[model samples]
Target: MIHLERVNGDTIWDILKLTVADHQKNFVAGNDVSIIEAYIAITSNGYAFPFGIFEDDTPVGFVMIGYDKDEYWKDAPAIADGNYNLWRLMIDKAHQNKGYGRQAVELALRFIRSKHHFPLTM
Candidate 1:
């Protein structure tokens, strides 16, 4: 029953507590940082939708999707325009290798399609 839950006051702490493996530390940013960036994007009139990947009541990971009109993307390549980026996706070290990552991505794509009415590319 893996699904995406919108990150909010009630679930922020749990989501922030999730972490990747030590070897992956350099690759994925902490959930706290992701949340902060999402905040910045929203305040800057951009779109950042952060979500907690959960299985039933347990929080397993975090994922975020962003639309490209933000000031941060002004200098980004043309491919960024009118496109949705799978900004962040990370499963806690304990939750890795359980296929949750793949499932979470599928859920994210469905979410994006439902919200934006556009097919996500890449």
Candidate 2:
């Protein structure tokens, strides 16, 4: 069963070990970087939720969601004023092309919806 697990001390190493394909390395940031960004965001008074994508007991990928009004996206664009952004989504190279990415996205969306009570744009 594919599900999302909170990225904590117990699971941080497993999430950090996940990586994308060589061709995708340029596009996706490493899990370590994402986790660092999450920490920064949280410390800056922004909302950041980082999760490990898992299939049963095995870690398969990572996803992060962020919500900020003026701290992170103040000058970016009008659409990002107060929306829940999918900051990161990464499936390890070995776990690619198996529908885990899609399932993980759906799970992330569901998670975002569950946390916020307002209308979501994405």
Q: Estimate the TM-score of every prediction.
A: 0.91, 0.89
The window of 10 residues in a row where model 1 has the poorest summed lDDT is 113-122
* Count of backbone collisions within predicted model 1: 0
Best by TM-score: 1
lDDT per residue (tens digit) for residues 34-63 in model 1: 999899988897888999999999999999
What are the lDDT scores of the predictions, listed in order? Answer: 0.89, 0.86
Highest lDDT scorer: 1
- lDDT (10s digit) by residue, model 2, range 56-116: 9999999998875436545656665577888899999999999999999999888877875
lDDT score, candidate 1: 0.89
User: In model 2, which residue pairs have backbone atoms overlapping below 3 Å?
Assistant: none
Task: Indicate the TM-score of model 2.
Answer: 0.89
